[model samples]
Target: MTYDLGVDLGTTFVAAAVARPNQAEMFTLGDRSVVTPSVVYRADDGELISGDAANRRAVSNPERVVREFKRRLGDPTPVMLAGTEYTVSDLIGAVLGDVLRKVTETEGEPPSRVVLTHPANWGPFRRGLLEEVPGMVGLTDVGLITEPEGAAAHYASSRRLTDGELVAVYDLGGGTFDATVLRSGPAGVEILGMPEGIERLGGIDFDEAILSHVNVVGGGALDALDRRDPQAAVALDRLRQDCVLAKESLSRDTETVIPVFLPGRQFEVRLTRSEFEDMIKVPIESSITALTRALASAQVTPADLSGVLLVGGSSRIPLVARMVSEALGRPTVVDTHPKYAVALGAAVVARAQRGEQALTQRRTDTAAEGGKDADSPARGKTDGSTRSRRWPVPVAAVVVLAAIVGVVLAVPHIVDSGPGSGDQTAAALAPISNTPPLASAPIPTAGSPLPAGATPGFAAVSPNGRLLYVANGDAKELNVLDTTTNTKLATVPIPAGPPQFLTFSPDGGRLYVSIFDVSGAGSEIAVLDTSTNQVLGQVPVAGQPYRPAVTADGRGLIVPVHNPESVWTIDTVSLKVTGQTPVPPDPSWVELSPDGRKAYVVNRGANLITVLDPASGKITGQVPVGAAPNAVAVNPRQPLLAVVNFNGNSVTLLDAGTDTVTTTIPVGQHPQAVAWAADGQFLYVVNDGDNTVSTIDPRTGKITATVPTAQTPTSISVLPDGTRAYVTNLTSGTLTSLNLTG
Candidate 1:
């Protein structure tokens, strides 16, 4: 006997099913996990590893591992692994081939026909890429369907849908989100309108948040690790697994304990479901927004839709059900096996194509009062009324529900505008120039007892922008990297106290590092000659300094001395302090104007930016800002000063020329530091509490992007080009790089 094969290739996970007789059997590969993570890792010896092994190897070999690749399908650029580039299709093919191998091992032969499913919002280029995969893997005859359509087919098989009845499909997977509305008719299932989808928000994002939480509050043992260490891989993999289990457990329970194990020390973290919901609230709200847009485009209200099918493994999160119900004013429809629903739908079609009897003893969900239906197969058998209806060929999610009496509907009227309804041609066909390659390094000082930026190394770009220097705290070393190759050029060892701040000369010829003691003593600046990549000399300062700013002419460096409450200006030529300007009780960071004429220092104790004339040790002006002002930034081209208020969770915009307050803009939780983008058009603020980098428009005072970082991001530096940025995560000890263009 021959069985039909179906493949469900997901961004975060992969699954396959074999259909025979009346039921679909999940094909397992090596492990019992019916779903395999779509990850590939390049082993130390050049071995290509996939699935669980790849995941297991990621902690130690992060740079060599590639996942979440499906999101970049049809992109002109390929993935780089172990110094080698791989096309998008090549990565996907690896997963498909592994699934096929499982099929051959379990079924004893290749399937006669195969059905494939992907997101409904994918455009022509992505679809074209997917279509080519089947042929590459030796699958002769392949039928393709959108994920939403496949899920609808699975639901339609068991539940009878009346002609013209419409159902909404909400599929939230690991890497993306999609919402579709489908209708059943005499011809079969057809899409009512354009599908709704969010490309970036997904389950994986939630996982990352939880992972960051682990790093921040999980205790001393858990910190960013160097992939070169074998334990690093094992530790990270364990943490991820624990997070997944904890997340899954929260679906049924109110709280779960996550176990974090290090070599000698281990700890258990108890997390509440409510807390998790809060962490992922943004994405949930986004999905709800997309859902409403899809409903509007479909011209179908919550009351008009027959069923709201919740598809994808991530839908199991209790928050999804609550949010969808609250927003739609009705409970969502779910299958007992929501994770496997889409694959099941494609599997049934595959079986039917193999000439097997389509009738099955399947669970049929009935439209009920609360909008919730049975998810288990024990509920009921397939309805004979919709048995003749088959999945349509051209694709969209298919769905059917019994309508009241006879309502003759000629055709689906779909609206042309809304989110995800645009001509998706730009999605895959065009090269995504904004997407940039990123590199990360473990801040050896992460989780150290020292304060935020002081312990976590901060990055600075040389004047010429050719090199990026990252000063580490506990490691007591400076990591010099080549920007062009994203490779480490050298590690310059410095005296032991964790570095709080550093600055490059205007010409990028010299580097100045402010090293501070954890106990708030022994403050000094180590001057490094960029040419030789060595510390030239150490200039003793009166007190601990956090962040230092360089003057435009490259002649002086303004250092904010914290404890002693003084700002010191050092002459570049003499390599000695010109003078110390006495300031408020505690100065945190300093910013200098373009002309090297003025200095703006954020005084933590004074709640103001104490302005000083660099020419002499004198106070020029003081701009009162929010309480606990931590850092300050200046726009060279404009007379704008941005002050990050730590406790206020906002940024106070000050007019440098008039020394007057201009605007008070709200920011993320516990804003710690601020920097002006090269153009002065935008400002980047590091939010330590939320582990996010908030990009704000200086003119409108509105946040543009809240890019998530590892944990406790303390310091951020951007190149003059504004295309690249580096953030130091204090607790996580991970130096994160970002592509500013996006």
Candidate 2:
């Protein structure tokens, strides 16, 4: 027999199915059912046991029995059973091998090919183990599909769904909760969004809650009963079993009696559905929150969803169903067995591979056919149908051809333009020379005036090259410097506390300041009007707002909240929060694209930049940066992104269009801040530990110069005309202005 198998090797359950020659005749092993509990045991003689046999041995030999082995797949720790040490991969292999043997025995032949289902968040290490399991089971060629994707494909195929249909899959399993949003079509299923839950949570948590309740009701006697008398211990064990039964029963009933037995005495404790709901409310609420976030990420409302499918046995809980329904405002579809859906879907996918069904072609053909039918009536009903329709066909074909030609012609221009495209004239400017003149004069810092009591943090020059704002943490203010005169003009008081970072509005009329607050009490952002040189307003933000940026239109300000997983968006006009978008942890800096449509937030903790659509509040993509991206600067004239890595001591240049790191330019020690020249001629980076400024030509992405500065130079910026630059030194408490014209 040529069997194509799909395996769902879950933490608490293992399921496998085989697609027959006839696609509709897919058969599941074990009485033709799709699921089996994932239980394993090792005998004293080192023989492996699984499924019913292992489950039967669980109570008698708890030490040697292993359940939920999938959870430990990524851990380096090994499990010792019956004096034999086995890794998580080995344990999983045992379960998978057992299932493979059953399929072979049931079909009276070995399976030809297999596909494995995995969680979306599985890393390379975990994926490696998953791939290894199929090999161990003697399946040489194996494919992998995410659990959610498998379930989504199943739903889409069963209903003959088309592409662009958004669906949410909420999987509450034995050890983890995963939520995913997918768009199904003829091109297959594309994952639009995915959010993970606590790995420590699941049905086991509910069981533990019940066990805890049993102990509480039995009082201290439950502990004594286990140790003092053998008969009492057995009776106490029975109570634990009864608690589990009652918990499952409460899902379909309003109340259940959990019986506790000790020696010759027996007592009954009643549990209401309300009490059970209350017990697991936090977890259920968390699941709802994850689902909400998944929808938000996909930029869809509950009304836009086709449906919400519940998968995994834990999703059978009454509270889980209720919470999902309430949050999504749609009835939960639990028609398919939660534990078997993924495996069944995978089996269906396997049949598609065997040419029994065309999964990808189904939706595409339907859409095209539907479009043709819709257009037929329009062409026939029009007054000048013959000529008008004929003209439209040629015109549309010409317009499409012209558009393709336009894109091909503009490729070079787009490559030269930065993300901002803010300065069209900059692209026409002559290329600057990288090699300084042999007789180049030293930068005139001899008469530079240092601000008193100012410990500089970061600095930036206005777009028009008139003023430079330096974050002076020790003085608790921003020292405004006159760029032309190389002198301090005024110290603007920052009531939001100590200034840590600064960015100017596109029009250069406002300055946005972020303050570092470590007490966890909270942080505040102070907006100052550049013309008035006075504080306009202060808005409270969660954690310390580490870095700040202003949108190109000056309509919004983005701030990174360090602790909590969010970025704060404030309306520049109203000076109020428009929204807050959750991000990866420890977002230390942010930068907006030139068009003001997208925002890039640097997640220091995750070592990646989350690209967000500010208008839709959705993360469009993520780009991996160097270790600890302390600062990010985007060139407006081109699709260039420069990130300074403090620990890695290098600047990573990313081609935003391709989302790939083009080059890594090694810089001085501890690069802290990065900025692009107004004309996009050069990229400047400040090295805090080395007290130097590294200059690179963006076209070549090579460091052309390393200009030494005052002690501990923390920030650097260039003038709009590209004739001068500014550096803030924290230890020396000074802002040094460099003459770049020479």
Candidate 3:
């Protein structure tokens, strides 16, 4: 059987995507790893090794290495590798050949038609080189796809955009940064204009920043040793590799310790996230600038774009996402799996190319027999949920787009024969518009929570996304909605007065609610069986509870009581009170880390946040915050916490590692609740006083946007896919849905 294959022949790394039946499966090259370093090296016995093996030996055998040859493409210069003078094209072909060989071994056959992605900014000169390199590696039939288009295909595959909508592709890969704008229509993605590129900037640049910081902070330790030792080159090479790991580490960690060791020298240094950001700030800014230029070139503004799709592994950098979104004033959509998105997109391209070619041939045959014109609109096939069709891709337009996009449109009978047999046909598939045009998002939309004037405050989404549990301050019951239809599913009455906060256990089997102002009830904790919306039991408490958090183990429901100024832990399995830990006065909010090792609680009266050990129910540490701190959140991926201050009108960022405030960022008036976006890179604070939601960058401690909401948005929650953010109004009884396409 023939396979549809896409190869992301990146400069620093190589990723392959093979189209199977329904999904595009990604495969590793050279080694059994998802990503292989795109480097080729010769060993002492003259055997060629690439990827991790080549990268590892580079530190000890620098003379035999050739890395990042993609940067040198289009140049005819022949560089000496080992004992042979191989051109940049030759080296790339070798890498491409290895990738193809590995794929053949896995798939039992070579790809019938290959889709090779290249940097969008490449012109005919450079593109010609890339185009011919694939054929040289024995892949006779190849379709050239821009790196940005490949990334766009990945975004489009999710069926999110409307037909003919403009979307920008912001690619920050391991070795390069590229920004391209494309318009998705019935005829697939057309180049918005031209592509913009940063020829030598990417994650590698960030690694260099760490190296430079080491030179300055290490106090000449690395540099002095580099000059004296015969293996200094190898030592510096090893340091570069270590720096790459450190840079990636900072993505999920606030700080990491760098250990510099030699045969007789050893030193350990602490590098903070802020310091690393400072070093790479300039290069990171360049990527944002390139995105701006690409937008301008496309004759489109930030507001005109549907969204910015950020792909490539380097995009994992918290700084890159924040900066690009800030510069474009657009919601940047980070690829869920950045490294493989491009390769997966390639497979989509291959399928589209083959299908279009087949459909086009059919049209031509029909046109000759008194049938519809070949240039007519494409025939479509829809199934209510998805819309896919083959639009007419004129031969002329195909030629023009191919040249501009580094693609060689394979129009069998129309175009001149170039690669493979002249009769061989390929697909030039149209862009499938999956979702209908999105209507203007309505803010301040009210939902009729039961009990008439009961005000909806906070909501929790089931882990499976099957149900949305909405809580209110005056309602005596919990309102449940089927997330698929956004309608009331069931309302369960509670034992407490009004539910103020709702949370689900990690397993999503049990529901926990924090209630306040119960007339006869001393405690305000309610637990329910989600399978039937039946009340399981209520845990007795001594004070009014404001927020509820489930421990990492899903065994304890931690509730913070305001009046009593203590946190109570209820054993979920036993359905009884476990223990209570005393904190500062008016402790209103609580959040646990991803690992569930510790709990962060906000004490409003003392203007501080206390860290508690869940297992022992004891205060471990306290960090001073703004006045009247109300809501607190910890980024599960990073050791950072965002604490909202009601009285001070600011959010203080705390590094959980040190239990200290790194920066306090001003926000909208009377910030009530704060929650992290999908990836935990940004925080959304609902400002009750101003009736707006502030998007905050937890890494930089800055507010990016203050979107107006319905009256008194008390709490917020983002969907699992980061597509939507629901904000509940405390007084208006409305649920504001924000289109968070990013």
Candidate 4:
């Protein structure tokens, strides 16, 4: 019998699967059915031992046994095992080899193909290691699939999903968490988005917590036990083993007894479900935050989902399953064996690759047949005749030949097509047009009649290059301007309270406005439908929402709250407060990078810009800016970051590729808002206090022009064509439109 294999090289455990003619099954190496604990022991003779053998040896030679090698997959250091130095890939290869041997033994034939699973967040370097490991085991034709994608594929295949259905895959493994949004279609599975969770967290964190609890109850002798003191080390190791068992047992029980053995004392401690939940509360919350962010990034809601599938062994914990269900308000599907699902899916993929089981072919039969016959003389003759014949040839031959040629050309065109084909074409052909019509446009000159005592704070044109939403602070309403006709479409009233900031959804269907209530009790976000110019709903926000940013998918909105040092995520569809993430104190503004992969938050209090992952709501990196970072902007065409410092009177430029501040250039005092010129050559910063706009050449990071504005210009917004810049002057109570193109 021939076999195809699937392997999941997990942090704490390794799983493998085999698929045959009519059966597909997953089994761990060395006698385990679902998973083989990823433990390796080094023998004195420079030999490596895995599986049950490694576990048995760990009791006698604890130092020689490595339990968490997967955590260091990206590390360059080699681990010494049995007097031999082995890289992470070596260990993984050994595990894979062992599994392949098992499959060969069982089927009497080596597997023809293999599929490997990896974390979605694994970057190029880590992915390289994953790709290299299989080669060490003689598996050359291996397909690498994301862990969450594998799980989602399994769910989709099992449920026989039709077109246009989305699935959110939450993978909480031993050392990492990842959530991916996928849509299953007739073509196959398409990955909509993937927001990764805390990479440093997993089941091992809970194990450590349980171990710490055991130590706390054991009168704080954990340090002694960890050092492996002859008497205490054995007791500590046994206690750790017990803690692990208890943690797993708690998955199905309300309470479990953890036994600890010491030199002269032996004790059993009863751990309750509530206590365990409390112990893991922080991690659970983090997971929920990641899930929420993923959904937000996908611009999807729980109600939009067909189902939520739980993957990874760590998700088996009752608390994890319960928290996911409670937070999403969707019934969680936890019936599948989390550890084996990925491997099983991989094996299925492997079998499909081997062409044993007939899955939907990615290529159409006509295309495949055309490809097969392309080199044949008969086909060549037909092609030559078609090219030589005129359009008025025999009706049947004309149709058939034309269809063949069209298919050949269409296949290549379809293969090269991508998400932004239409947008790119339109942008290439469109001419520059920045000015709005008289009726919808803001008056170019100052001293124009104010709109019913309205204090205009800022004006932003919608991304689609259509309407402009102007925040009228004094009038307590938003002035909607039509760009095409340059006319005011309508004025939508905003409830009076605190200063409000506005942002538009990705699709420009809705507008998000953050307002501070009168009592300072909290802030509220008002949602408006752009099509109707009507207020849809308002939800309370924590802290004072200063700069609001709608996620790229438009499902979630992020608003930076000053003073309280946090940012709140509002669910746009449900109009509910979903999650809150803490940021640096006194964050002045927040802007999403062009790719929508990261959020750059300027912290005036800390004089730094924190790079946050919007999906996971986690701070990934930070860069020191000027004295007080007041504004941040990202170039849409290039990997460049521009930051304006309120106190330093300088603009700091960053090369995003290296995450380093490349240069700094002096600008006007209190530069607040920065915008990129359409050509990406010039960056404009509004120096509010200086009443001037400083234009800097991004290539040289030098000041290019300093144009005076009305007194106390608060903000500056540029049209898509970059011909005019609308500056909001608070003191003058006027909008200044600068003719930059001229």
Candidate 5:
């Protein structure tokens, strides 16, 4: 057979289609079905089984099966089957190969041309990983197409699209949501602007939401089901499958019953379509907001769009279509088989590729069009032929420094820049202290601003350096201080327990407060809206969460926890725990390299630092530091990391690039916290035992200044302009402002 083929390797399902003269025909990969489960199982014989066979085998040997490997592409972490490790590419290649084998068997030959569809918001890194799949499947000269472009192509294949007409695509898939706008051009449908995506918002989230509702209605019976029981896992699996069926049944029917099977109990819960709609309303609204932002980024109004095209399995919900139409006030078109739309559309693109014509134009490398993070610096323009661009560090630093200088004085500032597409180093202004300006500089203290018996623990500054948030552990609240005046602006009450640690979003729009486990009520992370300082919601953790680090992408949080000896990954979009990675004991703090690819965790009990990939939570390497490592920080401008040793009274410096110990420098007694200066020239160590802050020149490995602070200075927050630093004292319940510009 000499047909062109398109394959959609989705998170939950896989679909394939072939292009004929004027139409695309879907391939039946399942028993009388057009799609197959995207799952793979490693049998005892070491042979890989996929689709329905794998799905069935997983019931008894769940440990050997892998699902949703599509979402883990680009992650260096590998999935372990029994004793063997399988890379994400290997798993995807297996499923893709299965699809290819079936299609080839039916047609009596392999397809001449093959095309694969991926999420529109995928940067070059992920796209590059997907580009390797075809070669592994014994296919050559394969093409790649964005999912939205494929859907738009399939839509245009049946209907005539006028030139310059704009159409929007709202793709809510199993694991992610992508919102993109495209325009009809001479060549094909071209993306108009940067696509907006919610990486954790999709059908899987809705399924979780429904499962949560089940737990609530079942009087927490599901929660009480002991997972340690051998039958519990299988019961829960079947319950989840029932939930998926119930969710789908409600799409056409008004109500459905979900059968719940626990270890010792079995029951059915009635669910109405209205209840299901209510459960998913908020996330659907979030998707609509993404669509609106995409249109705004394209500089076009909703009225200018020819119509809104809905694709993906999740987009078939009636409520989704209704909300899209109401939100944009435009006609919405839902595909008859939304799940297979991307696959069919890929066939269209594949046929065009076979003719030496690129149906869709690649986006130019620019600030708005290319796949750059929102905080990334502007990139040079391209001719819309290439898919990648190199991001220079100096150029990024110039842009980041300019933004910081515009907000603060014309002084060096450490702006925590987000990670760019691929291998783009985050830009931060280095503190150029060629001359040690201060020797034994003293700081003024803001004596106990709160009521008596209040213990302040941790502190952080906003990105703009306008506000400082102080966690009052004893008071069970967060004290907001105006940095200009060094006075209290407001106090926001903590929800569940005393606030233990505090961190802010990169944009300063939200603040995350880790709450202690009070009276065995369990711990949680309280989320607050910075604009109003009001508690928005809370994400429950399995154990007491220590200091959490927000990922460079700003879409997830890496939380180090105690009691269970694991780190949790929280998707910021849904405020839900997505994954857990086990680590050494007593993980206290987490720090990310400026580039954000690696996360460094300080294991206080183990006296070592564990380095892991932030995306996959897979441990990459480890560095042994001084005794009782309490805190860690990465230099903004250099490839250096500083780890504070509480018991050893020293700071261990490591090379962030190689994860190797560079040197160790002596400091004051009980150095509990460490921070890099704005220009990356100085290191600040907060000594809890000595109640002093030691300023060390890392280049010389000598203390430049030792300034007295409030009693038991436990945390430090340096201002963005490198002019001052604030130290929070736990015993004195006050803040000491140190002058660094002298």
Candidate 6:
């Protein structure tokens, strides 16, 4: 009949939950939704309204409605709703009161204990106003917890955390962005450093960007509408709602259309995910920079953290996750329901605080039997009561009171507390699946294809991660697979010798395939127009071409060859061999830096990697690696490179800037190829002898997992989002797809 409750007073939306022992349930607020809009409206009769009612009435009576008051917590000015002024505190308190009333009505009684969550960077002025909210709502036993701490506590309640492990929390909500660092130990999750935030960046801003694009496409029709006209105002409001829907659709779809309605004109604007990403990349990048600063201020590195926890509805953007992973060089995780994490975590904290207080009181009552005193050093004051637990929060002002929540150690077997819970605990929750889950298209059965003698050699993914190109040696053809559908889209026949390795232009418009001659007579480089899925032509060369790479500018191609042991640079425009430089024997693979300033060739016979100048075909530096370095991979975001040694069974990491070896890691036997997860968070090496792929953490130099594959896995291509990888098997003549989801 009694339970602890937690509330997240967010900027655009509010969420609440009630906790009882091991389980917590989210309250279905206005209109049976788990979350309620933070908007408030005052009627002409001096009646205050909130949530869905306020949202529906705002368009007709815009002057009577006010929203997003949380952002003005410390402002001296008051917001006017229907000619009546109210402080930010009063607005927030009304939102909280509505949420509490809903929960109480559902349970037929008010909650026994309450806890609220707020941004970590809020100073004394803002926090003090929040401290008065519980009293305003007629709640007595209320405590406050920082938003980041609440998120971390929720993460720890599910995932196992070892003592002293650090974790970073990235919270991007509807109207604000926050970054924080936390450490887990015997006590609980503790704040590691000052939390950082960007006040004006979040999902709402992204919606505005989409709206602006719509306006531009519609010839500023939206801006031309008159706000004084009642019909125009309604149309504008409807358009904004449409824009929000389009933005959410773009997250799961490749493209969407936003319908625009004006006073006299109406139109629809088509938007693609790529275009949306470009528009918001700057602000998202800025958030990553803030996250890096948070880690630095905590005196820790990305390698020091077990993982990064993404919290809030905005963090679900696919671009956000990919950018965070690549920028941090660490694994990033998003809970099943990021929007409700703070509320559920607050509930956990509320329950733990009550449990600890009760246990401490029982001990105090039995102090005669050798129990510690009530005023022992372990006992701390929370809500003027003794709680033998401590929660450390960060603050710059001495008078800013930081309340600790989420003592996870006191929780035993906590359930998921998520929406629609049914015998599932938080531990059972899985990471967010790819926007469109990868379909299990049946691979070729025994007698499906006609290429009987084909043996797949190498595979490559396009820049957009839509198409996969696999080179077949015996069949002398390229098999194109549509990654989204997980099915073969088409096949391009090779004109000359069997294709060994495949590369794509930076723009993903052209495909370059290295044709290898089996008789050691001669070879050529075959070019394919990706748009048409047809071979354009082949450039005849003297020696055997093993693998080739296209320059960043897409104007030149770099190829490493055997027999004569030389590297060739061909002008892509003229299709002519512009320059050839002699190198050590058996130059098997070649790669160019992102800026096209340097080229690296892995010479299998020389047992080292050779650096060269692509412009003049001149040798610049030779970094010694393990024996028989067969492949090299350049990190997409960082100045790092990895080389796989076939004979030595090791991988050598190099600093691309200085051309020096940073470290060498031991891997499985007979590693054939190495690929960097687009984020550079993980390095994957395909072991031919072991028939498995070893996932190596570049930061720790430890093999995190070994995934079994088809026999003799030769090459791998990880998708741009780092969700899946395609591997080519030499013996089986088949391709293996590995799920790389974290």
Q: Could you say which candidate leads in TM-score? A: 5
In angstroms, the error of model 1 at 526 is: 47
Deviation in angstroms for 97 in model 4? 2.4
lDDT of each: 0.68, 0.65, 0.68, 0.65, 0.73, 0.72
Better model by lDDT, 1 or 2?
1
**RMSD to true structure for each model, in Å:** 21.5, 21.2, 20.5, 18.7, 17.9, 18.1
Estimated TM-score per prediction? 0.50, 0.52, 0.50, 0.52, 0.56, 0.52
Where is the poorest 10-residue window by lDDT in model 6?
398-407
In candidate 6, what are the lDDT values of residues 1-742, reduced to their tens digit?
A: 7798989888888988888877877777768678988899888887678899889899787777887788767554578877899988888878888888888888899987888987765544355668998899898868887776667666666766677777667788887676555666566654554544544567877888898999899888877878788888778778878988888898899999888778778878999999999988866755654443455456677777666778888889899889878877878888789999888888877877777667677877768577656565332234311112244221111000111111000111221222222222111112221222211111111111212126887888876565677788887777765443344546667757788888888777778888876776548888877766656777887888888888877899999978788998889888998889999989989999989889999989988789999988899999889988999999987999999999999999999989999999999999999988755667888999899888887878888778777778899887765546788888887777765532
Greater-TM-score candidate between 3 and 5: 5
The digit string of per-residue lDDT tens for model 3 on 1-742 reads 6678999989889998887647677886645678798999987886677777787788777878988777766443576888788877877887888888888998898876678888654544466677789877778768776676677777677755566676666687877666555666655655654454545667876776688788778777666774545477676777777888888899999999887765466776689889888877755653543343355445666777766677888888788778767766778778889988889888877866766666767888888886867676443211111112222221000000111011112222222222122122112111221211111111212222222136787787765444567775665666665432344545566655777778888767777877777553555577776765666787767778778788767888888886577888888889788788878898888898777878888889999888999889988888899999998887745788889999999988888888888998899999998877655656788899999888876655666677887787888876553435677877778777664421
Better of 1 and 5 by TM-score: 5
Q: Which 10 residues in a row give candidate 4 its minimum summed lDDT?
A: 398-407
Q: In model 5, which range of ten residues has the least summed lDDT?
A: 393-402
Off by over 4 Å in 2: 23-34, 194-198, 220-241, 261-266, 356-496, 499-742
Off by over 4 Å in 1: 43-47, 53-64, 219-228, 263-265, 351-742
The residue pairs in collision within model 1 are 59-233, 60-233, 149-397, 161-400, 161-401, 162-401, 443-733, 463-508
Clashing pairs in 5: 430-679, 431-679, 431-680
Query: Per-residue CA lDDT of candidate 1, range 1-742, in tens?
Result: 6778778888888888888777776777537577889898887776667888787767666778888998777455668998988887888877888888878877788877688887665544466678898777777667776777668777877777778776767787787666566767665665664543545556777887788788778553556566566676677777887888888888899998888876656777888998898888755764564454466545677787665788888888988888778877765787778778888788877765444222222213233333343343221121211122245322233321111001111111222222222121111111111212211111101111212223455777654344566777887766665443244445566764666578877666667888877776677888876666656788887678768888777777888886677888788778788887778877888777777777888888879888888778689888799979998888855888899999999999988779899999989999987877655667888999998888887766777667778878888877554445678876776677665533
> Once superposed on the true structure, which residue ranges of model 3 sit more than 4 Å away at CA?
30-32, 44-47, 225-230, 363-742
1-742 in candidate 5: lDDT tens per residue?
A: 4798999888888999999767798999987578998989998988888998898988877777888777666544578986799998889889988999989888998887888887665555466677887899788878776677667767777777666777767777787666555665554444554443444556777888889999999999888987766588778777888888998999899999998878768888999999999888755754554443455456678788767788889888899899888977889888888898889888877776665332122222333575544354333211122223211111000000001111222211222211111111111112221322111122222222332136878899877665678888877777775453343556666757889888888877778888885452558988887766667789988788999999766899999999789899999889999999999999999988888889999999999999989888899998899999999998877999999999999999998888999899999999999888765767889999998888887877888778787688899887765546788889987777765533
lDDT of 4 by residue, 470-582 (tens): 77776677666433223354666666454467787876667788777445565677777766656678787656777778887788787788656887777777878677778
